[model samples]
Target: MKEIFQQYTGFIMLFGLGFFMACKHEIPVQPAPENPSNNNPVDTGQPCDPNTVYFQRDVLPILLSNCTMSGCHNATDREDGVVLDNYANVMATADVRPGNAGGSDLFEVLVEDDKDKRMPYGRNSLTEAQIQIIQTWINQGARNEICGTSTCDTASVTYSAVIKPLVQNNCSGCHNNSLASGGYNFSTHAGLVVAVNNGRLVGAVSHAAGFVPMPQGGKLTDCQVSQIKKWVNFGALNN
Candidate 1:
C-alpha cells in the first residue's frame, strides 16, 4: 500500500512539471500604419518671371552671340548707319509702339517683306519668337542702362576672344597686309594695339568724328561692344 501511494505522488509531481514546461509566454503584435497624404514629395513653382525684360542678362548676350558676326550687323556692313554694339545705339533705335512693329528701323528690317529689305541678308529672317522679344522690349519703353547700374564695376574680359576676331574677320579684310584701309593694317597684334592706342581704330567707328563706320556701314551687337570695352578697360590683354 505504501509503495503504490509513493508512485502515485511521483506521477502527480511529474505531470505538473511537464505542464509548466510545455506552456509559453505570448507577445502582442501590431501592424505598421501608412501615411495616406504624402503621395508626392516635390514642390512645384514658377521658374522664371514672365514680365520685366532683362537687358544685360538676356537680350545683350543673345545679340552678341548670334547677331553681331563679321559679315552680319557688325560695324563692317554699316547698314543703315546703325550699330547695335552699344547701349546708346540700341536704345536710340528701339521704339515704344504698343503693337506696331514698324516703330523702329531695327524691327522694320526684321519684319520686312522683300528679301533685300530684310535683315540678316541672304539668311533666314529673325524667328517669330525673336521678333516678339524685341517687340516686347520696345513696348516696355526701350530703357538703356549701362552696367544696368549707375556705378556697377564691369566684369573684366580679354581681347583675343572679343576684339581680335572682330578686327580679323571684318576690318582685316580691308585693313590687312595686302590692303591697308585708311593707311592702317590690323593684321598683327602689334599693329592693332598701335592703332587702338593712337585712337585711329576707335575713330573709324565714331560716325561724327572718324574716317568711317567700319565694314563700310554694318553695326556690331551690344555685347560685342561691351566685350571690347571690358577688354580695353583691362588694358587690352593679349591673352
Candidate 2:
C-alpha cells in the first residue's frame, strides 16, 4: 500500500508540472493595437488659394454679399452700430486686426458655433471658400489692396465679362433671387435688363437723390462706374 501511494504521488506531480509548462510556453503574445489618433492630425484643408487672397477682390465681394446687404450692415441700416460699407468702416466696426484672423471679431462671428451669434443672420451661411478667403485676408494683414495689376478695360466692355461680374459682386447680394430687396433681382440677364431700363440701376449706383445708394456698403470705383456707363451707352447688350 505504501508503494502504491508513492506511485500515485509521482503521477500527480508530473501532471502538475506539465500543466504549468503548457501555460507558460503555449500562450502567444499579441501586438498592441494601433492608435488611430497618431495616424493624422486634424486637417482643416486649404480653403482658398493662399497667394490670391486679396481684400478688395476676394474678401470685399464676400462681405458685400453676406454682410452689407440691405437692412443689415448697410450705411442706411447700420444695424447694431455696425457699418461694413467701406474699408475704413469695416476696419473700424468689424474689429479686424492685421495678421490675426483668430482674434478678429469679424472672423469669430463667421465661424461661430452658435447660429444665433453667427453672421449673415437668417441668410444662407457663407461657404468654406468664402470664409477662408476672409480669414486669409485677415491673416495676410487685411489691407485694402486690390487684386490683379491689370489696367481697367473700359472701352471694350461686354456684358458677360465686365457688367455681369460687377453687378454679381457688388449688387447681387441683396438683389439676388433669394433676397430681391427693393423688388430687384440681378441674378439673371433678364432681371438685370429690367433694372437697367428703369434707370434705377444707374441712379442707385450713382447715389443720386431719391434713390438708395446701391451696394449699400461702398461706391463703385470710378473705373467700374465708367465701364458700366459705357456698357449702357452701347445698349447694355447681353454679349
Candidate 3:
C-alpha cells in the first residue's frame, strides 16, 4: 500500500479516520461481494500469539486505528511531532526504545495516568490487553515482524473473543456514543446487531457494492472478513 497501512493489520488499520467512518449515516442497500482479481487472500503464516508481537498484525493496527486519523498522526497531520500511520514513520517519530517499554515514548504515553498526556488524546483509553500488546512488542525489541494467520478458521466464531475486540480495536473510534459518526454506536452489542440485521456488518467489510469499502486507506485480509461473515451467517449472537 502507498500509505503506511499493512495488508495484515488491514482489519485494524481499516478503521481509517475522517471520511472512512464505520457504518456512518449512509447505510445504503447491501450488495453482493465483488470478485476483484487482486482481492484474493494472502497466506501470512501461523496465528499470532501474545508471546510474540508482530508489528503488522499487532502494533500497527492500534496506531492506525487510534492515531492515524486525519488530524492526528497521518503524514498530513503530524500531531506533536509524532507520525504513526506506518511502521517506518512510527520508528522514526514515535520515540520507541528498542527493548525498553517504559523508556519508549510510544509505550510510555499509552500507560500514562493523566488523560491529557495519554495517547489517542480525547478518546477512551485502549484496553489493558491492547496496551499490553504494545508493551510486549516494544519490550521484545520492536521488530517489524509480519506474523499473520494463514488459515482462517471461520467455524465456531464467538462474539466475546473475536468479534467484540475486533470492533473495539478497529471500528469503535468513530462509531461509539461519543462520536456516533453515522448515528451508529458499534461499541455496543445492540448497535452491532443492528448492522448485522441490516447486512451493513457484512456488506461494509466484504466491500460489497453499495457499502463503503472500509479500512479507508487499507484493505482487510480475506481471512478476517471471512471470520466475520461466518459469525454473521451462523447468527450474530452476543455470546
Give the top-scoring candidate (TM-score).
Answer: 3
In candidate 3, residue 106 scores what lDDT?
A: 95
Residue by residue across 25-138, what tens digits does model 3's lDDT show?
467542211221222323346566647877767677677767777888888878988988766777778777777889889988888989999977898777798899999888
Candidate 3 achieves a global lDDT of 0.74
Each candidate's TM vs. the true structure?
0.37, 0.61, 0.75
Tell me, what's the RMSD of every candidate? 26.8, 17.4, 19.6
Tens-digit per-residue lDDT, 59-167, candidate 1: 5444543455565545565456565654444544333233344666667777888998776565545457566777675555544322322322246455655577666
Predicted candidate 2 versus true structure: per-residue lDDT over 1-239, tens digit per residue: 99999999999999999999999987964221121113222232434344856555666766876687657887888989887766667776777777788988889988888899888787656668678888987887766554434566787999988898788767776777778887889888889888889898888878889998866656787778889888887898999
Q: Which is better, 1 or 3, measured by lDDT?
A: 3
Off by over 4 Å in 1: 1-48, 93-101, 145-239
Ranking by TM-score: 3, 2, 1
Superposing every Cα of model 2 onto the true structure, what RMSD results? 17.4
What C-alpha lDDT do the candidate models reach, one value each?
A: 0.55, 0.75, 0.74
